[model samples]
Structure formats: structure tokens, C-alpha cells
Target: MKKMTRYRILMLFSLMIVGITAHSEPYEGVKDIALRRFPWLAKALVFNVIPGIDGNEVFELSSVKGKVMVSASTASAAAEGLNWYLKYYCNRSMSHFGDNLNALAKLPEVGKKVRVVSPYSHRYALNYCTISYSMSFYTWKDWERELDWMALNGVNLMLAPVGMEGVWQNTLRKLGYNDQEIAGFIAGPAFGAWWLMGNLEGWGGPVSQSVIDQQVLLQQKIIKRMKQIGIEPVMHGFYGMIPSSLKNKQSIKVIDQGIWAGGFKRPDFLLPEDPYFDKVADIYYSEMKKLYGEDLHFFGGDPFHEGGSSEGADLAASGKHIQKVMQQNYPGATWVLQGWQQNPANGLLAGLNKDKTLVIELFGENTNNWEKRHGYEGTPFVWSNVSNFGEKNGIYGKLQRFADEVYRAKNSPYGSFLKGVGIIPEGIYNNPVAFDVMLELGWHVDHLDLKKWIGNYTKYRYGKSNVNVDKAWALFLETAYSSPEVNQEGPSESIFCARPAIDIKTVSSWGTRKRNYDVAKFEEAVRIFVTASKDFEGSETYQTDMIDFVRQVQANKADQVYASMIDAIKSKNAGNFKSSSAKFRQMILQQDSLLSTSKYFSVNRWLQQAINFAGTKSDKANALWNAKTQVLFWGPDNNPKTDLHDYAHKEWAGMLSSIYLRRWDAFIDREFAQITSGNVSEPDYFKMENEWVKTGELYTLKPLKKRERDGLVKRILANNQ
Candidate 1:
């Protein structure tokens, strides 16, 4: 019996050694595996999982060994480990893995080092930062970051859909629309945000010919770079949402979207059955071919996003008509639709060719309406997350839900429909951990060890791996990254457009107003964040993200102090008031200084601070008066003329008004006598409150209009007088 046991143990040890050698040795030296079955997956893997593997070497699956299967679990683990390793030794940033989803599908061959090459590469400088507008007009730095991220994560296919405006312009002109009318259909540079949001019309148009020309040139460059790195580009496709200029020139019944607030008219929806539809489609395709060439197979466009009306027509027929035009223009083209907010109407889907359609299940974890409604619906789909909105600063997501959803999708009856996973954040600069984790899902398909993954990520992000940082990350996973019950937008409220100097009376949808956060946990996170910040502070990526994290912690701490003052005031203890008032004043001043010191303070934070001070009701009417003045004077609406700025200002103004209303009502009930006796009189108090109320009402009724410069100047002088 002893001899038999010894023999068995020797056999087991030999097998273990063989397994380790088979799995690790194959991937040695070769570095990048450019898998052709899923070329995109290879790109994503290399770019995200192995930051330093950037060369031209296609890795075949036959060379992979051991348990090198693609699934959420495996991908997540690999990404986590890769992130830690890169940060620990390479001193390089990882890209959001793209295309690597394919690599996760099958096990690779044993005893070969796989170096996957994808079209995507990383830009060291483009660490996540607030975009002035949208990514439609990417700068060279933007392209570099995108490419770097691609190479880091191993993405071989990229969606370069810019320069379509020029394509559409030429298409419209050929179909008899005048330059002015065609230009009216195009949006301005700043309006890209709204256009991407699927919310507004081409407000700032007619687009400058110069801008159109620039975008055309830009797309050419983007495509060239992507091709060099082995990434296939997905260009823009036509889905019948044409400029209204086509209405008179073509025999088509136009579906007008009315005014897109701000007095801008939406593009007219061209009927698919219209004779001109065929002509326009041909023109559009010809121009696309002329500029981008006929090498592309994938195209993206959505008809009637948000709340588009499809009245007076058969929705199913309309969808079929649109697809027919696309097929006729570019045979075998893949159509991409954003499964966002009841879009790609059910009737529309009924008419699409299942094999040709690629549905993006945007906001999958947040809202599973798509999966629940059409899990077995046969069309190939990819899971995605819109974690951030308007790139607002805040932390909120369904982390576990991400893993859960991928698991459910993989095992569902429509499992075959689940093609892969992706990250579609409105802003990619904030919540690096969330972004990292989400991308990792593409490589994993089962239960993932999140702790190990986080450790790996910390090592890569910090450039030098440390156990202390690893422990800190573990704490972060438990605290900051821990799932919250509420639906918050991002990690912290953006102070860029916050109501200036307002006390947070109510939490925004993004969870910024909550004062009951665990300070001890946050403090732990701060220590880790500060440590990581120190190491990467010199790197541009670190400067953009880590410095911001430090400032956010400080601001959040100050917010807690402000929240305490409000609690004290509500306590109604004169003794507490006597002590708390001075402290509150000091804290408010300190917060103001801290806010000013930060170069990138969000408007939301500024507004919250002002509101908090006003809401305290300390120092009789002076506090309220100052709060009210600051809110009304420095409101986001006081910015330059631009649709993006206008939208921000309107939001800030509404928040300020809401805070003022709450305070005004409180004062009327608590200090009516002071007002009647003229002891607390401000010349414009009544007018300001009334005007604020009116503005808020307007925002509710319709989007806020840009305040005219002369009118604003007059109001300012009147308030002073």
C-alpha cells in the first residue's frame, strides 16, 4: 500500500508540472496572438491584457494550451492579472480590450507563445479626460490614445464613423438639395454632444465646408492607422434620417421630429418607400466608397433614437424599407443598432435580417429590458454599459450585475445570440476600475476572482506593484467599487456645472447628494489613492486621473463637513448652533478655497457648495442672501453661447431654483417676521426667487433657452442697482 501511494503521488506531481509547462511556455516570447477567427479579440487581448506586446505576429489557436478558453470568468481573470503585471513592471497603461472576445471563444494550442496583433494601439497621453464635446472630431492625441488602447487590449476592428457629414452633404447636393439646406441638416462642432445623445437637431449648422473637409481627412487618417495595426473599420451607414432639405427635392413623405428644444429643427425622416430613397442611398454609398473605399463591411446608424415618432406608417414596413436601401447600396453590410431606451422598435426588428444585424445591448446590467424581451430573438448581440452620462463625475454601476448578466446571457436559450461584450461609457476618464473590469468580461464567461484581477490592475496602473497598494485595492473593491443599491451616474458629482455654493438637499440620479457615506472606508480609499497618485503623478494619464481622484476625495470630505452643519441646524439646539455656525462658516470658506484650487472642479460641486451654505440658515439672512446671490450670479447659464454650455447652464439654474425654493419656503415659515420688518431685506431677493421659480418652470415645460447677452447684462445691472 505504501509503494502504491508513492507511485500515485509521483504521477500526480509529473502531471502538474506538465500542465504548468504546457500552459505558460507556449505564450512565452511570441507575445501577441492575432487570432483570425476573431481578429478583434486578439487586438483587445494584447492591448488590454499585455501592454508591451506590440508587434506584427499573428498567434494561432493551435499553439495555445491548457485552459485558455474565452469566457467572462477567464477574460476577467486574465485582464486582472495582466493589469497588475503591467502596472507592476511595464509602467504602461492598458487599453479597453476590444476584439479579444474572439480569443476567449476557444482554447489555444499548447507549447507556443501567442502574440496577438490587433488594429488598436494605446496613446500614453490620452488618459481619460473631459472632452470639450464628443469624439466625432478626434484630435491626433485622441487617435493615439484610441490606438494605444486598442494595441494594449488587442482590438482588431474599430468603428471609425466620422466624416459622414461630408458624405451626406455631397449625397444631398447630388439629390437636388441646395448647399444652405443641406448644411442646415448638419450639426456644429459643439452640437456633436447632442447629436450623439440622439437628442437634438443640427442646431449650429449649416456646417462649415471647412469642418466637413477636415472630418473627411481625419477619417482617412484614422482608417489608415487602424489598418496598419490590423483593425477593421466599421464606417457610418444610412438608416433614412436625412436632412429636411431632401423633402422638396425628392418625392418622400417626411417625418418631422419637431423642434429639438433650443429652437433647432431635427432632421426629417425620409420614408424608405420614397423613390428618392434609392437615389439618396446610392449617392451616400458612392461618396462613402469614394472617400473611405468599399473595403468596409460594418456600418452603424439608428432611426428614431430617444423619442422619435414613427406615426402614419407601418413601423415594420418602414424598417424593412430602410434595410433594403442599405442592402442595395452595400450588399452584405452589417447594421449596428444601439439597444438603448426602447429604441430599434420591436416592429423595426421584425423586418431586419437577423444575420446582418448587430444589436448593441447598451446599459445591459442597468436595464435588462432587451435581454428579457428578446433573449431568444436570434439576432447577434454584444453587452455594453453606459456607465457615465455627459462624462459626469460620479461612481455608480451594477458590478456584480455585469458578471451576472454575462453569465445569464451565455447560458440563455439564445446563448448563440451573445456574440461578445463591450464598454460604451459616455465618459471614459472616470472610474478606471469599472472600465477595466467591464472590458475584462469579454475574456471571461464564468465566475471571476475579482480580488486577484484588481491586484493586477493596481500594479499596472501604478507602474510599480506594491503589497500596500494591493491591499488598498482590495479595500476599494469592498468599498468604492462595491455595488450600491441606488442608480448613481458616476463616482462623484461633476463640479463643472454644479449649482454654485448650494447645499445638497436632494440626491441627483447619480447619487451625489447622499451624505451618509462611510467616511472611514472612504478615508482608506483616499490613502491608497494618494499612494497610487504619488507614483503615477508624473505620467500624463496619472495626472489626468489620479490628481482628479485626490481632489475629489478632499471635496467629498468637505461636503461631509457641510452636511454636518446642516444636521446641526436641523437639530435646533442653540448651543449647537453657537458652536456649529462658526465651524460651518470656516468649513464653507475652506471648501470654497479647495474648490478654487482644483483646476478641474465640476459645476455640480460648485452649485452644491453654494446650496449647502444657503440651506444651513445660519447667521440670520446673510447666509441665505449670499447663497442666493452666488447661485443666481455664477450659474452655468452665465457661459458663452453653445448648445452644450446652454444645456449645462439650464440644468444648474434649475437646481439652484429648487434649492432656493426650499430655503424660501423654510424662511417664510420660520422667519416671516424678519421679512415683514425689513430687517432682512435684499433689494432683489423677491425678484431673484421669483425669476428662479419661473426659470425652473420653463425647464420643466421645455429645455431652457440661452439667455441673451444684452438681457443678461441688463438683469445683472438691475440686480446691482
Candidate 2:
């Protein structure tokens, strides 16, 4: 154990005091998030508030015949408190929305009062990166369910920037921009994350007025619901990100933020010293208050996000000025900055009042930017882990590393700067084990024995324990999810998500397309997982996860087949190339068929959400195009060989058969034709890719029957043998 300094010990005690004092009374304010998320439990469960529990997020549970008593500080916390009690004490748990619990057939009997207190003041969730890939097109229905999940999992703070476009539009309009100009300022639904980060401007637009207005209403619902459940909503702040044409439209001094990937125009930054800076600030904040209200205490924004030009500007002054406007509008507001590469730069942060700033270490799962920079020069930060990107389907996370890093950061010399820990994945659908452990760490102030914890997690994740399942998880921890190799950002890009390539290097721009784990071990884990399918067939979480693990094993084998084809091509072996290519196609088709068994893995469902949000024929076309463009070929249009093709690709049933498999088949057939003719005709990949992206065609998805899916999964696992 590391010896703590006097300053550190004192700070820890002070934080404990503050945290304990904050929870004086029980909070029974769980609202729509409860009703929408845990509809079964919400109705039957009777909750109460308990003051002075002596610990953070502490809840007392006692149950009668048909009624359950849950006492906590807030109803939102109470919901999680009740959930924790259910999972640990009663042998019942809810892992995800629509996830069934066999125990849900009957309520639990907590014979005596049971209490569990939270260990941390903050338990945060999500990253700005999550907004675009996993949730950009989300309506209130999606938000409602997600919020409920957050409450159940004990998320007290969340980055909830649902309707930022409306705020941007109304602010710009007050600054003399017309309707057409306002439309240009707002990016489409798919690009909200980067747009809010000031990375790009109007690239995926012309957004309709109706959409913007609808978002305003949507945000109101999100914020209100968040407040009811003891969760504090963090809104996006105005930090000098004006439209690309705002300079030409106004006399303000705006900096050209340069261009991003695929030649997209980055948003221009309004200089803090510009005479109209205060005027726009006043209007933007006023407009935000009018729509989203003034109760928000956290604001998130960063200028020059990712790659952008800020060569001449005084960033220190800019940071101070941005915080000035935020603090003025929402007094004592915590300015949330994405703690990413050299961002919230030393000189920049030097100017801001650090007391009101919260920096999220965006990639803490891989990079230790917090310790490397000495905890953002003493400003408060949250240790966060971003284990996924673009919501691309792949099983990956540093589960043990998540526990290790959070524990170390909490005890390091600069630990005082570590306000708390959070889970900030670019997407949240994959790797439920990673999230479970990360959230559990928030309540564990002591070091975690992962060997012991994994057992509890396996028990609760499936609602019952089976030795085969536990062994599979143990193998999983040793293989796919726990490999200790540093690859480029996010999960290793799946070949199933890649556009057809002889030598695939990346699926998304800058994403590393390489496997770093033992393929055989992962397959063995999947095989072990499959044996329990019959035992846990009724469990949704178990079935969904079994499909995912099987899909990963098949995809990895499919990649090997792809490599063999590429190898054959390199050696000019036409016969071998044909054989290997055929196998690659077969592997993808098999994986697709296997994925169709899970309801959550449907391409039709993913696409329909985009379609459902459309208001007009043009709106529908553009909306659908936005959906396809983002996931397939995120682009700037002129360049046929855009490096950003297949950036956010999914390995769902329809996408595999229709898009990726089609592309691979085209590539293979072209090569075979050229080889036979000896014509020296080179295949035009860009043409086929562009043609595919331009077509707003939705493919047919055949969802399999339970027994049919089970049989297919069994057959798929046999290939691994």
C-alpha cells in the first residue's frame, strides 16, 4: 500500500465529509425514467426516503408479500439501490432494457432490512463520442430507456446534450442570422457529437426547421426527467463555435478551424476579443435558458477538438472567456472539457478558474493522459474509460485495466484532482461486462479482486450460475476482452465492418484494423459459452451475449480467410484465391445468419429509426442518406477514394449480407474475371463503394426463430472446433 501524504489524507477526509453531508434525506423522486425503464418493478415497488444513512447512495430494503420497500436519498438513487439489493440479496437483476429475469415472474422476499451505501459522490456515464454513433438519432423513447438504465446503474451525472441544435439555431437567429443561415449552422442528427465539439460545421446538413424545433421539445423532456431521478444533466456550452460562413455573414473576428477527415469544413471559432463576443454570449445563454432552463450546473464544450488550427489565438484568454460566459449564465457551473490530446492546453487551462472545471479523461482505458499531465495541472478530473468507437459491433474492453486504473488514479499523488470515475465509451451496446465492473468500481473505494468479482457478475448477468458459463467468462477475461496489447483507438476494427480490401488497414479513419488476441482461446471461450445456451435459453441477456460471442469467433476466423485470399493474391495463385474468397463470403453469411437470432442485432431496426424521424419526402431522403453516409462512407463528396469509407459499419444481419458481403463478392469476382481473361484490368473499388453509398436501399432482414437460431449457432460453433 502506498503511503498517503498529509495533504491527500486531509483532502480525502474532506471529500468524505462533503459527500456524506450531501445525502441528508432520502430522495423518492424517481420519475418517468423509472416508469419507462423498470415498468414491472416501478409499479410493484414501494419506496421511501431515509435521512442520515452515514454513507453515500445508501439504501435500505425490506419487503412484504406483494410490496417492496426501498429507502434512499433520491428515488433515482433508490431505484439503483433497489436494483443492487435485488441483484445481491434476492437473486434477481435487470441488466438491460427488455432483458428478462426469470425471477421477474414473482417478486422477491427481503425478510430483513438490508442496506448498501455508495462510496463515491459522483458516478458518471457516457462520453461526447457516444452522442453520434450510438444515440444521434434517438427520440425520447430511446432517451427514456437509456435514462432508466442510468438510474438503475446509479449514474448521478450524465452528458445529456439532446437538443443542442435548437439552442444553436435560436442563438444565431438572435444574432441576425436568417432561417437559411440558421439551417446551415446546425449539422444533421448523425453529426451532433463532433458538431458540438466544434470539429465540423454543417457537413451533414441542411437540417430542417421542424427537426430543430422537435429537438427543443425533446431536450425539455430529457432535462426534466433527468432532474426527477437525482441525475444532473450536463448541457453543451457555447464556446466560440460559429458557423463556417459566420465570418462572411458577420463582421466578427472568427478563426478558420481548418478541415477534418474526408475534407469536411471545420466550424469557425469566434475570437474572445471580438467586440460582439459578449453580445452573442448573452443571447446564446439567454436562449439556452429559455428552452433548456437555468438549473443546469455543468456545461461541456471544447474549441479545436481533434485536429484544428489555433496557431495565432491566445488560447488561455479564450478558455477564460468561454468559462466567463458559462459561469455568468449558470453560476458556479462546472465547465466540462474533454481531456483529450493536448486539449484544454496548459496555457489555456491556466487562464480558467479551475474550481469550476471538470475534465473527462476521454481514453483512460488506454491512455493515461491524467497522470502524464499531472492531473490536468491540478484541475478536477474524472477517470474515464472509452472502450468503443462509432458503435461498431465488436467484443472488446480492458476489464481488469478499468479496475486497476481507477484504483491507481484514486490513490495517486494527484488523486485529489480525480473527482471520481466514469464510463465514457463511444458506444455502449457491446461489452456489458466492462460497463458492469466500471460502474461497480464507483462504489468500491478499496481495490477489487477481479477473480472474485467476476463470479458475482456472471451470476447476476445471467440471473443464475452455471460452471460452464463461469469458465467461459474466465476464458473471455484471459482472451478477447483482457488482451494487454495497445492498438490504435477503440476496438480492433472488425473485418466484417470493413469495405472489401486485399490488405485492409482500417475500417474507420485512423482506426487500427488488427487483431491482438489469441484467436483459438477466444474460440474456445465461445464454445464454452455455447454449451450453456440450453440451460439459460430463456434469458435474453444470456441469449444476446451468446450470439455476440459466437459472432466474434466467426468474424475472427473470417478475417483469417480474408488474409489467406490476400496472401494468395500476393503470390498470384488464382486457384487458392478463388477458394479462400469463397470461404470468406461463406463465413460472413454464416455470421450474419447467426446474428439475426438476436432482436437487438437487426439492421432493419437500426435503419427504421432514421426513417421514423423524417418529416418530409426530402427530409426522409436526407435523413436516410445521413444514416447510410455516417455508418458506411462518411464523406466530403468529391474524392471517390475517401479514406473514411466504412467508418461506422455494423455487422448486423442486413449489412453483412447486403453491403459488406456484396462489396467483397464484387471484388472477388472482378479479380477472378481479370485472372481468367489475362486482361490486366484493375478493379475500381472506389466506384463500387461510392455506388453502394449513394443508393438509399434497405436490405431484407430475415429474423430467425429461436430454435432455428439455436441450431445455426450450434453449427457456427462447430466450425470453431
Residue pairs with backbone overlap in model 2: 26-73, 27-73, 27-74, 27-75
lDDT tens readout by residue for model 2, 78-121? 86776676577555555542364454677667877777666566
Candidate 1 is scored at a TM of 0.66
Please tell me which predicted candidate would have the highest TM-score against the true structure: 2
189, model 2: CA deviation in Å? Answer: 0.9
The CA root-mean-square deviation of candidate 1, after full C-alpha superposition on the true structure, stands at 15.4
Show model 2 residue runs off by greater than 4 Å. Answer: 1-28, 31-40, 52-56, 62-67, 95-98, 102-106, 110-114, 483-485, 719-721
lDDT of the structure predicted as candidate 2: 0.78
C-alpha displacement of 701 in model 1, angstroms? 39
How do the residues 580-620 of candidate 1 rate in per-residue lDDT, one tens digit apiece? 44443343333233323222333343333323322223321
